[model samples]
Target: MNAVVHFLILLVVLSAAAFILFLLRAPFWLILLVIVAVYMAVTTVPTFHTVYKSQNLRAIDRFLLRNYRKPIFNYAYNIGHGTDEEIRNSLRTIIDKSSRGDARHVYSALLGVHSGDGDEVLAHAGKINPGPLRSYYYAYGTALNGDLDEAGRIAGKITDEWMKHTIYAVIAKKQGNPEEFRKEAKYAEDASVGIQHYLLHHNFRKMAESFNLSQEGSSMMQLVENTAVELKDGRRGLILGVRDNEEIVQYDVELGDGEIITVFAEEVRRPV
Candidate 1:
């Protein structure tokens, strides 16, 4: 039986018992205690079943069920360290269970790209009901697979100007066309922060190369290390090292206030 149905039956039975006790002139406090106990059981049992008794839940789903918050950071951390099969299974679970929403679609598409399965991304995109955003994600998958022209054609179908410009900027960045990237960046400023940070990192490496210094051991590297940076969470930290993982760059930082934390590179910026 459904847990909710079971809870409703239990509630009806307890209410009947409480009513019988009242008619029999039992102590008011004792009847009230029974009612309270029934209420607590009804509320907690369903939650317990959802969190602990559900069968075949993926690790991420289990964490979400227990914590009641999307474990995005934890997922990223685990993906960075997990084996390929584990990562794929987790992503597949997320794609299957997440509700239809832009963020969910973006995550699914990105995971497909990260897993080097552009076809899967496009297949998922196609399954979404027809809409401009659906076309945009399909374009994004194509762009990730290095089909810039086709991606551009699909992006051109988007009616929302901001969405169109943002996706075009992504395609331009992937194509390594600085002029095109800048042109798209003008209209998509808010959407381009991460891409801009990635480009800035690339340019910094180029500058280091021009000066005949090792990219990892240059003056720029020293500056990045010594700089007191502000993280996205608004905590100030000094960068300890950068880990350029396959999916994203992470900065290992020691916060001035306390504790060591790993922040995404795009989230760590020098104080203005």
Candidate 2:
């Protein structure tokens, strides 16, 4: 709707320019330059206005700002180029005023800023329309707030087994219970389980080693880490770490682009 209106305005402006040029007997080159200038101003002015008045912009305008301007703002914020208060206000406005799609992206980015009050952000996210994504963040925030029971209850609303288990694994880690962490990690039916398992064992090697596996089990674990394997998701990644969580063996894999992911022993295939 906004695009249609903007297009119509452009057409009217061009028609008016042609009429004025005819009345003044303007030179053809001068008329062409005027039209180009008007076109540029019409297009450029709105973008500047939208960026400057983002909180007042409509949903579509906010979406556009998120895609185009937010990244630049985030970069500036990260490098300490922007004042902390200014950055916080801008992000808070974006989270509060933007459409759901735009708000979600901004919220995710805002989570990376350590100085922000996480509980406050989670409370804000809970007020948004109910969604699995929002619930995921809310549960994570609850866990971060040290409310494990509340986090677990919120995570229970997640129907996806992979996501539920992943959140549970995180909760387990926060509780510092290796056994519970391994139990939840085992329930994760995706590469995420591998990552969580790696994080747990890497961070708590002594507790993980106390499982007391046989020498053969140790050698197999070492081999799993040394080998490159194809994940069930079809991405081939080199195993960077391995964990023997009782009966489950999880491997940390680094993909070609250097993303650390996880995969189960069963997910591994001989590198072709």
- Candidate 1, position 181, lDDT: 65
> In model 1, what is the error at residue 247, expressed in angstroms?
36
Which lDDT tens digits does candidate 2 get at residues 217-249? 112223454454556677755566788899998
Q: Which stretches of candidate 2 lie over 4 Å from their true place?
A: 1-117, 120-124, 189-272
Top-lDDT structure, candidate number: 1
Q: List the residue pairs that clash in candidate 1.
A: none
Model 1 whole-model lDDT (C-alpha atoms):
0.59
Q: After best superposition, candidate 1 residue 232: deviation in angstroms? A: 21
Q: What's the TM-score of every candidate structure?
A: 0.39, 0.34
Candidate 1 residues 146-199, lDDT tens each?
898999998898986656886687676777666666566556433333223222
Per-model CA lDDT versus the true structure:
0.59, 0.57
